[model samples]
Target: MENLEKAIAEIKQALPGLTLLEQEPLAAHCSFRIGGPARALAVPQDVSSLARICSILKEHQLAPFLLGNGTNILFPDEGLQELFLISTEKLQKLFLLPDGAIYAEAGVSLSRLASFAQQNGLQGLEFASGIPGSVGGGVFINAGAYGGELKDVIESVVCLYAPDQGLYELSKEQCAFSYRKSYFSTHGGCMILSAVFRLQPGDREEIAAKMRELNEKRRAKQPLELPSAGSTFKRPEGHFAGALIEQAGLKGFTVGGAQVSEKHAGFVVNVGGATSHDVYDLMLHVRKTVYENSGVVLEPEVIILAPDYKLEDKGPRVHGNIVTVNGPAEE
Candidate 1:
């Protein structure tokens, strides 16, 4: 707490132009519209500014909790008083290289990135047109839908290694992408700066048509009208989570404001006034019932943020005011 206080003071003096929100409401910033005030949320305009903020936090022995579009995370209603947050909201630099690869900052929404690709007559990213996450978050979780993931197109990633205060560009293979997981997600201490995507050239109208088709399918099946994270649980090996959940008779199950979506069994929607605890309890119940019925354990896809309410399978997580970045989580 003392170190966070010191870092906060130093950051104010060092980067006056940066937008620093002290005790900012997390609900106002996330898609789920949940969570209480964060201790501090810093929005950097570009990569260098973000790096500078990380540096200051690291000096204080703090590790920042990186927030993207907040589509796949659950924050506690009690608020994160000791955590320092870094938002990729303003890191919006995106363009194409002369060699035809697309370069994007962490903050670029996946939908926008897909649209940009379609506009340039690029194919392959059509499946991402409906995913509601930024490039950084998408890359972090290898966000996928309709048979496509960010990993399929991403060629490289440039990130800030917090431990050394240096930058490293990792190749696609080095990223070690897999089913909703990545090097960045499993390994801590590295902050994604930007990424390069390689795509195949295709007819513009054809690309747009494919994107439209995928988005239409997504809208028809998923609960776009509700406030919720995308998927509540990862697909248990060889079995679909939604099907298993529905077969367990948990369809439309509710705990307070949180309910399993009747529209799609995979999603847990906030009908209204849902607290983080509401979602958490509902998920726990779902996990319990589903396991009891199906003999398959479900793992939460949503990143729950609360010291006391951590999932049993939780790994190296950075809580508190000290922002430590990639140490050994690096490789």
Candidate 2:
């Protein structure tokens, strides 16, 4: 409460254009449609506002979570403590740069990027045509689909380093992209603002055809109609995590409103009004059971945020056998 007030005051003083919300529900911000409330939510409209918000958070000693489209996160049902939720959803901007490059802000959605690329006869981004995350979020996690990743297209990224100065730029190499990680995920000094993507000119019809094919694949393989994070867990080495879970006979396993998608064992969908805890417990069960049966510890792809539990110790408790169920089974 004290920190919230302090943060609000500092933000008002520094960035007058910023909007702040109190006790904002996480369900409204996440794709999972669950979570209690954030201490405060701040939406910065521009680069200057974002920098000032960052400075205010730093001054108030509060670490705000940098949220994107909230397409891949699961918020806690118990809610978060005193923290600010910084949203870049409105910072959307795009430009067709010379030399066949696409420039986009962090808030720009992948769908928009894909559309723009297609319209401009650009190739190499059709794989991300249906990805639900923002460009910044995509870059933060090296988001990928259909054998392509943001890393492959991203030439450089511009980030704000308020702790040091105003803005900084990092090349793709500097981004330190791995499977599902980047420098931003590891080191916390920078926040992505915009990025430059190098694309090649291709036939528009071909790009559209490719996009259509990928979308069809998703429609067939993934449960796109459900409220769920796309993938529940990362692909463990030597085997598909989903195959293992399905083989363990855990598909359609429900905990409250959350269910391991029968269509795709990899996804945990909110069949109804599933709470964060329900999904969390289900993921834990899947990881533990998979490890016990096959000795492969599954890692979740979805990021969980809850006030009561830290990310470090919230996963993997029961493993040996199925225990007493907590939530109701899906019909």
Task: Pick the lDDT winner.
Answer: 1
User: How would you encode candidate 2's per-residue C-alpha lDDT over 55-168 as one tens digit per residue?
Assistant: 777776655567899998888787765567789998888989867799999999998999999999999999999999999889988999989999999999999864564677
The true-versus-predicted C-alpha distance at residue 93 of model 1, in Å, is 1.0
Candidate 1 local lDDT, 74-189, one digit each (tens): 88898888888999988888899999999999999999999999999889899998899999899888899878888999999998988788899999999999988888877887
Show where candidate 2 strays beyond 4 Å. Answer: 13-16, 310-331
Q: How accurate is candidate 1 locally (lDDT)?
A: 0.86
Q: Name the weakest run of 10 consecutive residues (lDDT summed) in model 2.
A: 321-330
Q: Model 1, residue 51: displacement in angstroms?
A: 0.9
What's each prediction's TM-score?
0.94, 0.91
lDDT on C-alpha atoms for all candidate structures: 0.86, 0.81
Q: Score candidate 2 by TM-score against the native.
A: 0.91
Q: Which candidate leads in TM-score?
A: 1
Error of 1 at 85 (Å): 0.5
